[model samples]
Target: MTTPDVFMPRLPWDAVDPYPFYAARRREGDVVWDATAQAWLVLGHKVARNVLAAPHWISDPRANQAATAGRFFTADTVAANMLFTDGPTHDRLRHAVRDVFGHSFISQLTEGVESLCKQAISTIDVDEPFDVMSQIAWPLHVAVIAAWLGLDPAQCQVLREHSPAVIRLLSGITDTDTLHVGLAATTALITEFLPAAADRRAHPRDDLLSYLATAPELSLDEVVTTAILVAVAGHETTANLLGAALIRLITPTAEGTRLADHIDPADATVLTELLRLDSPVQAAARTATADQQLAGVHIRSGESVLVCIAAANRDPHVYPAPHQFLPGRPGPSPLTFGHGAHYCLGSALARLETSTALRHILERRPVLTATPAWRDTPAIRGPHHVPARFTA
Candidate 1:
């Protein structure tokens, strides 16, 4: 079969609602070669799951012989963490921190998470269009992750300033200035974490840094990189998800209001549906280690595959009325937190934080005063600012 000639939509990355774009691609085929993305776009739910679960598809961009969408820095230590590793290396890195983010550990934090949510929510002005992204979402997640990492106030402030720049590297950006800034921020973060990691080694504490410092499997450098990964991803994903969820619920739509008013945060499925509707991390990039045929399309060894998580979540075959936000919708789990070995390590914490925050916000009866201004970062999607007021 001839490769489909469709291209990725040219809309600004931040402002563009990618659901429509995904829907369009799915119509062509489950898997199509996108000349613009310079990779095979996996648009179907099953195809994405298969690709994600398959051990042969690697995360290390350095393994790609065929061109991929993003730039990978060999010297960038961020690439050394579990997010970019594969095989035994991936397993080892993930296993080291698995227990800390396990369901049991996360369950213990429910009350604490709710308390943090309430603390942040209590300070929001109820009478005006306050920026929820800044006032609540960002600060709340940052504080939670920072506390877990045992960071001081100064370190926490540095993370707030530099984490986003470090995240920009994930988008496969080509801008020279942006790349320089991101790399420099990455270095700064490493430097900042070094002291904490060292302190933990000398005088171990109950925090994540101390745990990492003591993990026999990890070296000093490994601990620092792994800490950086957890610290950055710990807040970024949840903050983005929380901001998006709030926007959807507070947008004054009938469905939004119905769910916000009636949905129970205690029901895991409700938050699952919300995640399906607005996936913060839209796509997962993988490189085929060997030749394979996927969804009837031949994938060459070393070719890049862009598993479009946002598209797969809304796959018409998987979810009925794919675009509609229907909680308790009976279908397979969304690939929002990913699948298989590479699944998000902090999935439980993220769910807890989002649900807790939403429960608190809904209690306040938030109203969106204006449309959210979306972030411009690549791959990651969330509002940079959500203008809103609380009515309760």
Candidate 2:
């Protein structure tokens, strides 16, 4: 197909800022069929939310118009997870481990998490720039998830090693060289977590891994896969969220006290605003189960819809001064964690982790002298490395 046919196969501003591209396209209409991705891109806040929660939208690409004859990377690695499944299968998996998100469960981790957060910040050399993504965000997330899973927190090194490749599995990078990385990541993660699940079964304890291992409702593979899901999914996205939030907070416009200063880290609104302004997972794909009208655009059955959460969060009609990060901004929640049936299972944990991390940093009062480099993935947004020099 010619350039005119694709209109812009790869968006021009993808490497840097893609918001202007989205805003320009959004001005034409809320949902438009883009030849680039060969999918309907939903940009309006209301319309995107509607599409996400709609009954006719499917999460799995194969369930649509047979988008691919086989899986994007390896057959079951990406396909077996609940994120791609819909209906009873999804519900069965979700219900099997829903208790992980309970208030009682999350509330118990506060003390331990707070200590870990402080410890993570303390390790940063007081005189030089430290990559917070490695020193602070990544380790803290791995530690929390590990502790909860009944695994030694020291094993975070494996997670640290494989996180990037595993992340690529979800970001839709399935080219030959990248697919090998994705496959290797998937194998390593499952290999590590499965044995732990078995050990949990052999020696039952008062922890999530043990509970899953013993749960009569789950198969052994389910226990292992779900544990891997919890361990992997629970932290990285949250790490990304915290990483992105930290970068934005460090350089809040030269106002008297930075929003990170006077604001209560635990305050939901503060996190909400931060999430809206710089979302971690910026885009998601949904397939149309049936023909539907979204913002007056006719969508055929078995077509794909790309829900641009980053764009929707900044919809001017829904949020005033959407581009600016205003911690005090009120009304309308951010869709960063999503909404409806598949809303993030780990959102509570993510919020608690981020709030704790930020509070600890502010107490130390470190001056970040340089900006962090943002991740290159088109859909997932966060710092691959957050460089900060600690100055007392």
Candidate 3:
């Protein structure tokens, strides 16, 4: 058995800035085998897409128990949702939730999302240096999602408090104890709400949860998991995107202002450009089902591969001036929201939330500009403390 050629480099965990590291990696080629991590790093746009779309590649960590055991995710909390499944299983769950979260359904929530954005923006301390992540981004997402689900306002606060811990775990920042606590809190939230929601379905209500409850094929466990997925995935991903987008907006660049001056707020293409430049979900891993060769590199069965979406988005050959943020840049969409069958279900909702939040910020606080203190997380990238002083 011949050992695969491996390009060993330290994981960019300690780097205050990882973009440069990713850039260096991308310069090497599309697929670089990482010997140290015992995984292949897919960095180019075409390669990442192929990797994501490949049927042979498995998203379920259980496929590679030894590699993912103590690192990527805890087996106990990994839900068998569409995100982790492939083929028929993914198709079933996706269809089950489609009516509730499809583009048309999510579009209906735009007005409510905008209202929540306005309300959240109104509370921002314009004169003081505020942590935008806490003051605006977090609250905006929490309020919009809670209202969409018809969750109690008080319970939304509990979700907010518990959510950061969950986000930490998802972002690969939490230890075992923290992960357990976060998972338990999240699971408990679902357990409490699912029963009431199930009852609400019998009576009928005009909310996302009620719509979800009506899914005939979905089990109680699936319902709970789905709801939990919405709560966590819906809010956290968009919150981070908002934070990242704000950082770009305030960075004192022509590209930033050009992006802010867009005519249509709901333009998915422009948002795609922004995401490509600064993706929130930076890396996602998958396991190989069988020994396969990609771009002339051998990937053994059961070994994990981490697709660097951020790096792939910036592949120079595919994207001109990849480092520069161009709102008008024309190209393929980024993989921030994973590609193929596992594309993010909450993608439309996320875009709506981000667009509304950005519009509110630009309209109310035109002079908003500041350097951001970025969060320490490998999986999700965002500003931890974005101090901005805005004048009305």
Candidate 4:
């Protein structure tokens, strides 16, 4: 078969520099259709905000399930979770998770998250190059989230190991092999958590699993699915976020100032800017529930709308100089964690993990020991490895 002449941004897909493609898309229109993705790309920040608010745009793929839609779970079970639902169902699922993850509730995890960060950093030699994703971010996040859910950290490591396929599925990669891998990994994740859920039911503890397993509002399947969702969403994205920030913030730019030098552990503002520069989940798709208007374009009912978060986050109209990576700069919070009712419930937890991890490295002044290797995937953009050695 011959390759189709598609309109997707051709170049820079694998490059560390993806801004030029995003910049060119913004010049085209806020809502331009990409035949390659078979979805409309939303690149303007303000337009993206509006698209998020529009009620007719729904996250459930069943609304217009593509022929090749990924089977991340038995579709019925996974669709019941907040990440893939809408309206009252989404609200209910969000509420169940939110009660435990609310700002004040999650603040309690800060002490533990910090301790985990310290533990991770201690494993690396003072002046030795280490892969931050594995050595620092992944284990630190997995441990914190596992402790919060009242599970053993060692088992939680499996969730991280199987997370890349989840990212691929969520970001709209629906190839057969990718879908198979995602389903297998997802099954493994749920199987690992099943015993935990059962144990929580027999002896209810004052922890996340106990609450979830016993919640009257959630079905048994919902409980298992939600646990898998939280396991991946809670840690994987944040690990990528941490890796992205470290690669971009610690390295010296042509201007010679580094973002790490100015990071404040308690400052959400700096985290916001960094999120815009290096988004964790780069793209997502929503099917139109009804014929509607989005970004001045007439989106037909049942059509797939692809929200290019990495593109929207870099819109010049939103950020004064969208291409430059500057921490602590003034800009609205990024769409990386998403917006409206579908916004990530674990946003606060992820930010806390990232900022805390960043502060630990900053205090010691880490140096990038080698060129960073970015994950060469279009759906999720982040560094595969960021090797650094603290020079304090």
Q: Which scores better on lDDT, 2 or 4?
A: 4
Model 1 accuracy (lDDT, Cα): 0.81
lDDT of each: 0.81, 0.75, 0.72, 0.76
Off by over 4 Å in 1: 1-15, 65-72, 75-79, 254-258
Clashes of each: 0, 0, 0, 0
C-alpha TM-scores of all predictions: 0.92, 0.90, 0.87, 0.92
Per-residue lDDT of model 1, residues 1-392, tens digit only: 22257332221233348876777777889998876666788999999999999867988756543322234456355345787788888888888899989999989988878888889999876676688989999999999998788899999998999999877666452355666787789889988998889889999998889999999988888899998888888898789999888777667664444457667766888899989988988887788888999999999888888888988999999898988778888989999999999989999999989988888888888888887899876578888998889887
TM-score of predicted structure 1 = 0.92
For residues 252-282, write the lDDT of model 2, one tens digit per residue.
5766455556667777778888889887777
Clashing pairs in 4: none
Per-model root-mean-square deviation over C-alphas: 4.3, 3.5, 4.9, 3.0
Winner on TM-score between 2 and 3 is: 2
Output the better candidate (3/4) by TM-score.
Answer: 4
Better-scoring candidate (TM-score), 1 or 3: 1
Q: Candidate 3: lDDT of 160? A: 83
Q: Which digits, one per residue and each the tens of the lDDT, describe model 4 over residues 1-392?
A: 22355232211244466677767776778898766566787888887877776787887655544524433345676456777788888888878778777788788888888888889897777788788877887778788878878877557667777877776666544566666777778778878888888888778998788899898888777888898788777877888888888887788978898766766756777788888888877777788878887768898988877777888898887788777756667767789988898888888788788888888878778888889888766677778888888787
**Deviation from native of the Cα of residue 92 in model 4, angstroms:** 1.3
In model 4, the runs with Cα more than 4 Å from the true position are 1-16, 65-67, 70-75, 263-265, 326-331
TM-score of 2: 0.90
Question: What are the runs in model 2 whose C-alpha is more than 4 Å off?
Answer: 1-16, 64-70, 73-79, 252-258
